[model samples]
Target: MGRILLFNKPFGVICQFSQDGLHPTLADYIPVPEFYPAGRLDTDSEGLLVLTDDGQLQHRITDPKHKLPKTYWVQVEGVPDSAALDALRAGVLLKDGMTQPAGAALIDTPPGLWPRTPPVRARKAIPTSWLELTIREGKNRQVRRMTAAVGFPTLRLIRYRIGAWTLDGLDQGTWKMNT
Candidate 1:
């Protein structure tokens, strides 16, 4: 058992603690010292991020061998039809490799979702839709790539859950020490 901190990371916040001199870093939001992010969420992405003080625990959370499931709420440029959804469920091939089977489904906009500061790009002609996507692997830009492969590019991506931990009750830019 070690110190675990669950943070609702805001979009545009860099995952690292040190200042990048261009964007806000974890240090801006998290004042706690000696804790590091268990895994990375891209600066363009938002939502749940787990941090820990124990090195072994961090390894467990980040190691792909653990197959820890991560879920995201994705807003895409186009409405995903059954075919697109099926493709996501089966596994979509990316430049890196074929992704593992994922859990994908259409979902309404998440309740109580905080609006992104710089808002996602929008088009008056194309209507957007939401999807709940869960994946076991932590490939680089996998979710956005997955949606793009299926012809529905992701406009906004927010990580909702990682393993047993979730973003529930965690507000953007805030963190809490898990008991």
Candidate 2:
């Protein structure tokens, strides 16, 4: 059987196993050998990152053609109304091309959410709101771009789930092997 691992990758931590010549990587947390990340979350973003030893599993999760949904909790700079939500659900045209239609809705703050380090800048006049967005494709910075396109710039992004797996009890920089 292949080993499967779920890690809550914190902000500023690279998803790669080694950071010998770069910033902090998975090596700083998980000690498991021969396992690799199923997908990548940028260092500026935080959330669930799955690792596995099976090559096919990695391909299945990372390939956009598979249409596996990745859910994110995003805090945007302004409150989005029904029309904005509709636009996000329909699909947002980006410089890379038009993104696939996504599943999006306003969401309450998740329980036990950790404060991000070097926290996001606050705006006195502008209020922020959270939204749950599930996208089938993982284009570079797609969530941030989509929210921005709808007049609500993203202040922070946390991916909470991928397919059937989720961060669940995993804390920042912590890993659990369940396979």
Candidate 3:
């Protein structure tokens, strides 16, 4: 029988089980053996990471051909104007290639948001804003690059959902098993 685990990965934690010397890893939080992450989240990012013992299920979630829509709440260094939002929705050019069109919008602070440790750097002169972005492709540092391409650098990124799964009730560094 296949099993699934939804993990709420905290910021600064590595996704891998191996030790990297300074940062904590999934091994510290998830005690389950043989389960592998369906996808990866950078150490700087925070939110849901789906893990499963089934290879096929992992492929579906991470494979480009499946196009599983992933949603993120991004905090950026500057407020995006309509043109910028349009650019994002229309797909921004990246070093890898032009990204697929994404669902992009400016949003107020996310409700029930947890504060990041050592909170984002603030500048009284430079303003920050939140954006909700959904994309089907997973590229390296894609969200950060996308925001930076449109004149706003990502300050913090939180993956809120992957297809039907969400970070809903999971707190930071917690995991729940789905049998």
Per-candidate clashes come to: 0, 0, 0
Best by TM-score: 1
lDDT per residue for candidate 1 within 1-179, as digits (tens), equals 77999999999999999888999999999999999999999999999999999999999999999999999999999899999999999999999899998999999999999999898888999999999999999889999999999999999999999999999989899999987
Superposition TM-score, candidate 1 onto the true structure: 0.99
lDDT accuracy of residue 88 in candidate 1: 95
| Candidate 2 lDDT over residue span 1-179, tens digit each | 56789999988888887666767889888888999999899889999999999999888879978888999999999899999999999999999899888999998877899999979899899988999999999888999999999999998999999989888888887889865
Over the stretch 1-179, how does candidate 3's per-residue lDDT look in tens digits? 57899999999999999998999999999999999999999999999999999998888789999899999999999899999999999999998899999999999999999889969999999999999999999989999999999999999999999999999899888999864
> On a 0 to 100 scale, what is the lDDT of residue 69 in model 1?
96
lDDT for 34 in candidate 1 is 97
- By TM-score, the better pick of 1 and 3 is 1
Runs in model 2 lying further than 4 Å from the true structure: 20-22
Clashing pairs in 2: none
